[model samples]
Target: MVAQDEALTRRLSRRRLIGTAAMATAGLAVAAACGGKETSSNPGAGRSAGKEEKPRKGGTLIGAQVSDVNMGTGYPFVLLAENPFLNYLPVEPLVRYRNSLEPEMVLAERLEYNADRTKAVITLKPGLTFHNGAPVTPEDYFFGIDLILNPRKYGITGSFQLAGFARFITDMKKVDARTMEFTFDRPRANMTDLFAQLPVVHAASYEDVKNGKAVAGTGPYIFKEWAPGQRLVFTANPNWHLTDREGGPYLDGVEVRFFADQDAMGLAYEAGGLDLILDAPATLAKRYRARTRVGPKRGLVYAGLNVTSPLLRDSRVRRALFLAVDRERFVNELGEGFGTVTVQPWPSSSPAFNPALEASFYDPEKAKQLLKEAGFSQSRPLVIEHRTTQTYVNIASVLKENFEAIGVRAELKGTEATAFLAKLRAREFQDVWVTAHAFSDLTPVTNFQQTFPYQVPNPSFYENPTYLDIIEKLSGIDPLSDEAKRQYERFTQLWLTDPWLLPLQPTVPVALLGAKVRGFDEYFLAPGGSPNFGTIWKAP
Candidate 1:
């Protein structure tokens, strides 16, 4: 049986549950005089962070690459309404994100939830349009959900998010062109916010999706050009729906430069050719934060063992491997400072956390004794292979030495992200792999739903029956009042009794922004808890 955390921990170290929308919403309240009884009825139209600072106008932002989704029509099969990562054009789904990071309403004026998390009623801001000049309607929002619901549409397939959503959702009717009434099988507190999950597609183009073409999305910017693996460009939508305080995008275009490795991105950043690098390693982040015009990225690292390995089949053997190494010393090599060693899959900051699970410590002699008892004499070396990347080679090397000292023969299997993840997904190695997870949102269940394979992203190969049960409990759309606490206890018991994934500290990505860059923090954030560079820009 595997350990599971359905209530979700904030950090990835403990294999926590998926996080919900952020609790830290910015209180950028506007003057009551300027504010309306409810403000404009436009999508994402609420008065959020109506900053006194003037919006800068007229410059393209050039930056380095993070993940490789938007360089081209990766989803040519389903014409993407908006590149999930590169959102040069901003739009709304009633609730839009501030800096496009978390859910904040723009289109939908109000989000009212029923008591059971089964249903939600909404009121939208009126006269909202997409970058393509399409007027947004309730049918459009309905079509967005339909895109993901219809398997033939080939959208958000196998998502744990749909685990709850697929249950109670019933019908969406257009109360009027702008006002849509969404009813459910029971009650859904999250329905109005589900758009936070899938990118909204144009209802006018539903025929396109049925015809086997990707639907178009209305946004602030239109995809003008993409040069795969090299450079991609976007021209601002002349008809962009939202503008700055004074209606200014302040620039005509945005460019994103891709590099094969971080070193190249480093070179570009130093040469003042790049504005930001959202995908650098911890070691590199420390280097750049000290020497360059960059900032830190919030990242997580943990030791994940392949449960299928015969050598680690025994609980004693698994526990021995963990006790053998010095995680604190090893992580010191990355220089992100001492990260809170994960006691379990959840972050120590989460409400459901139990600090008692952090007791797993470094004990090499004990590790040696356990292995010997497990029948490993000097005749055989406990072979462990670690997969890694150039960014953390030094730390991986240190990890190898620690395990080797405890009567284990650990080999370095450092590979790049593509190859490394391929091996991970295939479960080809019998040892441990050091990796990080990009949390989807603030919701603990979202985190758990995602990692536990309740349904989003992709299913986990490390699937355990024990974990599956918890998934059923907490992932229920209409969760019981005690479900949160129950899930937390179940997860805590699993970790304290039988540790699965070892916890690690979270590190921030080191992003080097150029002098011309103005909106690095305010915008250019990634969606799904990962880095998204859609709002990034460069000088004209």
Candidate 2:
């Protein structure tokens, strides 16, 4: 009934699935040798380009967190954990990412998968301890998962990630104090990646963590102090397992100062008060490129349309609305030339990106014709509601003009972060709202999973049983296999055919580091999200 992708044009590449169990096994020796220094998969492979400066640790790194607020307790809360700005510092997961952004052991020493791929044996690194001096055990990991799945006791009622994880996972058992086994209800295509990303919490103090009394994590940085709404401080954990030349957490401490405004953060960065600004403006980033490190964020900034709305229910009207807006102009205005125009939800760098899918060109005349055919006239023009942040208010204004030129009246509805998310989940928009969502990881499956209602329900209300069926088939299949490729191709087609969200552009976030900051590229990266400043050091 809705648009779908064309027949299989090409198969999914094997390179996308290179990090298999065998590859992970091979990385064990290398991981062990580095002492969790976050070395690339290969030995003797260093990411630093210039003359390797030996890391000298001492001073505290004062930086700005991308998010205005942290949950205070990031572990076991799906909403809190999803934002990397909140957890990367205080909450350490079992699977730490490498310089290449590949999942490797941090807390866990070995990850072994069964031949059937339905079960996994995770052997934790021995003698690991939490920030509160609690010895981390397999019981703690299981308890954390349990708390996340059933978090009524923890104050959080429910979450999509928690519900989805509970639905797939069958059981988790402690083999010994250091070893644990996981049995999945169904084999997962990205099992290791998924498990590695989960942040472990101390079972002994789950209630304290749940009640916002204390944060008991095994991360490099310990929760030292919090001023709330102003500044949060973290001291290097003395008992942290991960180590480098300077022992652990190259910096003695990290101070993440929160700013409600980006301009204020930029001022702080320029004044040399802050060490790093992970979400610096494009202009500021360009001005400070010598001191800044830029990377592809692999995220989407788009407008999610309400397909259930009577005015938007028609496919013709939806297509007309997409054609009416100038995505390039919006990117230039809002993203400041640091963004690329995107047609589908997948970024250009993504494996799921379809080059064959023709870009939707802005055609006002054609948009008007389509709208006219849908029975809208001057007396009864199509009314649209656009909700977004003050940051993109200008882009929304331009979008309003674009729509108005095509005989559509657009109204801007701006809201804060929390309210915006609540609106998105409730589908409380009149027509469409300008918003964004990111991939939990680099996998194409995550893109589909986030959009699909079953896995991780998106703001868009569009649903199809056929699309769901194809995604189910993709589960546990080899990424390079013809079956997985076919499923991906089929799903891509379906996504194109039924565009619930309009993909505007790919965001290339800039991380502007001060002169004193070292290991910006080496240790302060989280593949698709914010940088992890665990091993970052300030020049002595």
Candidate 3:
């Protein structure tokens, strides 16, 4: 399943677990019944989101993860999309989302906009310092933007979003040590959300970061050791803003252990080797959902058709592929009713979600007709490649079976994550590939831009200038105006008609937590299944 990028690392696995209070099941039920009114925090918040237990001080929490931290640039380089759960703990953003998903002041005390809303002036919070004892400065903020916009020797993603900001914001100037001003070429919506996701680091430490040496930030944790494929260790930042009296990180330190198998991670958790299991198999998650926290994730698992490929170039073929697949069956059998069928990227919670879009019929006869009209037959079967995870392999198998029912022969190709990403970026594929793409920002513009044609290599070579223009126009639309509503509905229609990629379902990620752990907030689930470990403590 996909995790929210703005929050934590998104785990690809289906199931995971974390801790909860004695009344977790009842609380979760109440929260769900209320439409998440009380549990508005995003997924991966652990059990702390709804519990009232007073936090105590001092304990070490151990977590088991499936991926290794070999990237070495997990700190301040989360844009590279590696080890964000580890990297983001030591570094913080200027602003962050509260439980309401609203922008909350963090390092930046206040953010203001000009009359036209084209410029933003920010004032930093006083008395903030990096873990290395260096006071935070406006130069550090500018440096963070530069690192993302014009990255040098940094393995990063999100360049598109950063580049867009730099393109629209004509200039940036530091006013003082703790203040700065940004002038935009045009009015932009969701400015705080965009800036809140950038990782800030001290400018003086850029060289150290380039040399693979870790630098401390103003976050609650201090980097101690990153043992690559084994485990990562972090200690409490003594000089952090949140003091013990303020309910600051009650843990003395935190450890993240890496395991190759989900079963092994579960075993470690069951044997008390791990305090939390962020992701696990569905069967295992079923046992702990009542005791631990469980909820639906805000991401979608979809199939991206290679628009450039000969087999999938025809619109009819793409439509046929979408029509042939039984999304409801996939959700029922593969997802085991844990997920909801998705025809588009937006989750049901988002205003952009279209109810009518889900009514598309599963017509095998129509799919066969489209394939025949597109000049395809069993002799020339369509072949698609996907990542080789067991869960994804099973999903692909279900899709293959559905395609066969329509007299359309389909071949499934499985590969590792690294290889799959490399090939995808290179635009090397036959028909389509499965991916769990989720947007950290809830804005519809981001949903369109990321999937729209840009210079960078994306899964779908869906280059349409008109669609791009509409996306830009939507960005400036007044949220509550009739025009904005019209634009939203128009975008929905465009998405249903063209559908650059086919969304199968919104993944429901599970977490497993040990009974001793406390202050595990269910809102901690970021784009990745990772949580803010600093808020959590252990009971005596």
In lDDT terms, how accurate is model 1? 0.48
Q: Where is model 2 more than 4 Å wrong at Cα?
A: 1-52, 65-67, 72-76, 79-85, 99-102, 207-213, 244-247, 347-349, 357-360, 376-389, 392-395, 426-430, 450-457, 523-532
Candidate 2 per-residue C-alpha lDDT over 113-215 given as tens digits, one digit per residue, 9 for 90 to 100? 7877778899888788888888889997787677656666655443434445545679888888799998988766556545645678787876666555567
Backbone clash numbers for all candidates listed:
63, 5, 36
- What lDDT does the true structure give each of the candidates? 0.48, 0.60, 0.61
What is the C-alpha lDDT profile of model 3 across 1-540, one tens digit per residue? Answer: 112211222221211211111111111100011122223222333445566667887888787677665343333543333353565567777766433334557788878877667888888989888888888988888776666566543544333334555556678998988889998878776455456566677788766664445665777888777766788888888777756433677888888888876677778777777777654556555556544544435457777787777767777777777778788877776665665665655544444555545543477777787778788744476776777756678878888888788776788989876666656655676677886654522444545544322222455877656556566676765443445545666555455445567767665545567777766554432222335556778876
Give the CA lDDT, 0 to 100, for residue 235 in model 1. Answer: 62
User: Which tens-of-lDDT digit does each residue in 1-540 have in candidate 1?
Assistant: 222222233233344433222322222111010111111112121113553343455677675664343212223222121233353333334554433233556556666655554445666666666655677667767765664456445432322234345445676777666666656775332343354444555677655433433335555555555565666666666655455322545557667776766667767776777665544455555654532322222234556665556656565666676676676664565545434444444433343445554544676776777777688543444333443435556656766777778867766666654455445434565556666553322234445543322232232245556666765565543222345656766766554334455555454334444555543433222233322233333433
Models 1 onward score TM values of 0.69, 0.83, 0.82
Alpha carbon lDDT at 120, candidate 2 = 84
Query: What is the model-wide C-alpha lDDT for candidate 3?
Result: 0.61
- Candidate 3's displacement at residue 445, Å, is 1.2
Sort all candidates by lDDT, best to worst: 3, 2, 1
Superposed by TM-score, candidate 1 places the C-alpha of residue 367 at a distance from the truth, in angstroms, of 4.0
Ranking by TM-score: 2, 3, 1
Model 1 quality (TM-score)? 0.69
